[model samples]
Each structure stands twice: as structure tokens, then as C-alpha cells.
Target: MLHATISGNVVTQSTTATNHSILAFLTSTIGQISPARIRVDNNTVINNSTSGSTRGILVDTPDTSTSPSFDATVTNNSVAIGDSINGVSGLVAQARKASETCTSLSGNTVTFPNGTPSGIQGLRARQADTAVYDLQTSVSCTGTAATVLSCLNPSATTEVLGTINTVSPGTCLLPVTP
Candidate 1:
């Protein structure tokens, strides 16, 4: 059930065993609350299914100036369970591969698959600076090249890895009230 309206200090507890999805877009303009207390657990959110233009539990721009603090307590959810569905991406990509040459990425440095480089920082870093990335399968590899995650697993020898997933901020300006 979609929430009619979520106000300040919302305490939600849901136990849904069904396959349906819940999409709540938390935004900077959602509420007057700077940090909205949110607790989500035990939900199935497939990217292609839970997505319109974005993916699962997206924090977007319905409200850009609200500065809602999103405390996501997501746990125990099945995302990729397309047991009987085929080609479920809804929107068709022109090609199976998406690539773009980013000049800005040159000096950024890359983290190889899930393997951390020697003498580098560990995965347990601050949320503001640390990155959480996943490498999914893409059909852009040669015969020997598998997927980034496949290769990263070490068992899958010589998988073609995509660039370290990076998210440089797009140009967005949230209003600041004096």
C-alpha cells in the first residue's frame, strides 16, 4: 500500500511476504525534516521492476530543498528473482552495451572489481567518501571476457571489468533558506 502521506517522525514497520514492490522516493524536498527517520526491512526491489527512470528506493527530486535525512534500514530483500520472466528491463536499450569516454575519469583512479589494491584504504570508510558499487553482467566482452562480478569472484578467470563505478555530482542546486 502506498502511503497517503508520511509526516515528520514516522515510525513504519511492515512485514510483506508478497512479491509486489514498494517505491518511496525520498528527496531533499520531501519534508521539512532535515533527517527523516526511515526504517525499511524485508522487501523485494528489482531494479528493472522498481524502476521508472531510477532504481530501488531512490532518493530523488520531488522535493529538492527539504533536506530530509534518509536513514534507510533495508535488510533481507530479494532483488534478482526473475524466475520466469524474460527480458524484463521494460525499456529497451538500443544496444546491449553502454559506453562513454569520460575525460574526467582519467586521474580518478579505479578500484579493480571487488579486489582492493595493496596499501589502499579498506571498504569501511565514511559514507560521505566511501563508495558502494556492484558490477553486473554486460555483454561487452570478448570470448574470454566474462562480467566484472564474474571475474571479480576469482573463480571466473579473466572477466572483463567495467570502470570503477563513480558518481560525480551532476549540476544541481538545492535552495537554501536563510
Candidate 2:
């Protein structure tokens, strides 16, 4: 759904999405205009087996001269993805500009039963990624395959401030407490 001029919307208690081909469970790709608060909680996103990139939640603002600040809260959600999927990220917040703030993902469970070498980023933030960001119970490699179950995917960006939980099983979560 598009958030052109909408703000302060809360999406909660929703079921899993059958549309797995899209970018994420909740995504906002507003351009220069920054939408208001969007809180997503207590939702379940399961069986997302898209052949392409399938992420859990995404708050994406296109790169501009200045960072478009966004306010989002995602919590208490359960997400599961199928194996053999590529470009799969659990939680992603992309602010390619500067000075963007107030985006948080906490208490969310994400699991990848099937693994892929394409890499699974549990929680990632782009330009605004700083030490202040980290995955809480996010980032778990399931199904026990050495080649696929490697949650040690490193950050390509230099501004990652939080620790990605490169651990295993039953501990997949993310958080950005601002």
C-alpha cells in the first residue's frame, strides 16, 4: 500500500501475506515527502517464498539531497521465509541521504528454514545505519546446512551501528531504539 499523504497509521493483528514477490511486509517508498508515523505490530508474515528478494518490513526513502526522516515502529511480529530464496532480508530501513531518524524494529522474530548463499540480512539500515542499530532476536539460520546456514553476513555499508545477531535457531530478532 502507498502512503502518499497518509500518516499516523497503525497496522496491527494482520495475517501472513500471500504476495511474497514484493519487497516487504510493510513498505513505504515515499520520495521527498516523509509520511507520518506508521506502526506495524502483532502481525504474522509467513510462507514468503518468492524467488526474488523478499523482505519482512521495509521503510525506504529514495536517495535525495537531504534525508527524508521517517517514523516507523515494527514490533512483536512473526516472520518466516522459505529456503532457497535470494536477497532475503528480515528488516530493512533505507535512508540514503543524511540525518534521517526515528525508525525502530523490535521484538520481531524472523526465520529462514531454507538457506541461500545470496545472504540473509536480519536487520539492515542503509545510509542511516549506525552503531545505535542492532538486531535483537533477529538473524537465525535454520535447517542445519553449513553452506546455507551461515548468518554471519557482514555489513557492506560503513554506518552500521548495531550488532547483527549472527547466531542460530529461535533467536531471530531486530531492534532500533531511538
Model 1 Cα lDDT, one tens digit per residue, 99-161 = 111101010111223232233221110111121221222233112213322322332111122
Model 2, span 1-178: residue lDDT tens: 1222222233321224433322322223433444344556666555454544555556564444443444555555555555454546665655444434354445556656575335555555544433122222233423322221223222221123233222233222223324
Cα RMSD to the true fold for all candidates:
15.7, 10.5
Q: Which stretches of candidate 1 lie over 4 Å from their true place?
A: 1-20, 28-32, 45-56, 59-62, 81-178
For candidate 2, what is the TM-score?
0.50
- Clashing pairs for predicted structure model 1, backbone only: 28-66, 28-67, 29-63, 34-69, 35-69, 36-69
For model 2, how many clashes?
9
Scored by Cα lDDT, where does model 2 land?
0.42
TM-scores of the candidates are 0.29, 0.50
